[model samples]
Target: MEFRGLGFVPLFIALWCTAWVVVSYTLTVIYGHAPLLMYISQTGNYYPENITFKIGFLGMSNATLVLMLLQYNFILLHAEAFGARQPMIQRILLAMGITSCIGTAVMSVFETDFYPVTHRVGAFCAFACGCVYNLWQAILLYEVPGIRRAICHIRMVSSAMAFIGVITFIGCRVSVYTKLCTEDYEKIIEIISISTEWLMLLLILIQLVTCFQPMQHLSLTVSRKGYTICKRENQDSAV
Candidate 1:
């Protein structure tokens, strides 16, 4: 059976992410101009609190990340329980969310100024997990029945964007790190990678938009204990 729509909660999670992007972008603008090749995290650092954006941005972002992760955790776990035949897929989704949350927190706290190497490690973890997370989500989006009719195309497009972004970032990293590209070329590649990152994020927001309406068709209820209890109803009633 396919799950058609995502519950209202996921939309809230997407909103948090949007907030993160806006705040971070605004902060970067307020500070002295940062080169495009520089990572977004770099924008959060080395400036006075009032003058810089990333400080407040990361703090708020971390909170949102935690909330988003927790929401996905519950969502996927419930999916696993009901979607028995594909337990592994559901489990992996949950794992990705948790790992991404950890990565976000680590990257948020360990700024380039205070912990350059650690910061990079956190960034790598977050990006890699986030990419894979989207990839898996794409699979589920296509395979799941209820929402697939409307979202299959969306999933394909969003996942494709995510993969393109991941691949470009990897290629740019290899070129920059190996000194295979000139400084100017490397900078340009880095900028392209950043653009792809934002593109992937935008796709996620789009995916959430599609998921919101269909959740109503799924007979998922929140019990008194605040747990998601998926009890599929008769087709007529669900509709």
Candidate 2:
């Protein structure tokens, strides 16, 4: 009857997907500024040159920040649930998830056209750290008795897909830079890279859905200390 933490899972996914769709549609259909096969970063580039750039930039940056907060909360929940079994592993997972989230935010904030080096670095951090985090989480879930076996298996498959997607994305991009392929081949590779990037994003979102069931019973609480500046001390404390 109570789905406390489950709402955030869908909310995060919806916001992310909505942002991508709105920005992509505006750029490709409304403005004709980019083709359908453009990479995710391309949608947000050329700030101040087009109104769509502002839409893409703000949408992605805010969405990624929301994702960052969601991931941080999820890591805290996992640590609370499973920290007793593998404290060090929990710490590592928390670090990796947060790093990936921050990387995503960085990439979203720094458009590829304006900040090429910084954007590439951010993309590398996001994908690489995110891949490790997903795989590690799958392994961690496997060792837990309370979690469903189906969820563990689903995470394993999704994580594997994400790994392949990352490899394909990076390989395609590298091939483009090498200039070893013909122009036609370069175009094909670029399309593949863009498709793989989207696929990887979907896989990551699916992985997040797995947390819903496990976190259904969990609820977040906020409290203020009696000694805080905004509040008076409790009568019991004075006594």
**Clash count, predicted structure 1:** 6
Query: Model 1 off-target regions past 4 Å?
Result: 1-6, 33-38, 46-85, 217-226, 232-239
Q: Per-residue alpha-carbon lDDT of model 2 for 1-239, expressed as tens digits?
A: 22234346545665566566565656555455567667767766653333454454455545544444444455445565565656566567667766776677777777787898898888888898879877876776675445678988998999999988988888888877888678978878877888998788778777767765544434444445322111112322211
lDDT of each: 0.60, 0.65
Top TM-score hit: 2
lDDT of 1: 0.60
Cα-based TM-score, every candidate: 0.73, 0.75
User: In candidate 2, how many Å is residue 49 off?
Assistant: 10
What lDDT tens digits, residue by residue, belong to model 1 across residues 1-239? 23433355456657766765666666566665465445667666754422234444455345445444543443454463346656566566667766766776677777777798887677677767866776666566554445546566776677677767777877787787789999778768877777776676687677666555445444444546664534345534433
Off by over 4 Å in 2: 1-3, 6-10, 47-85, 226-239
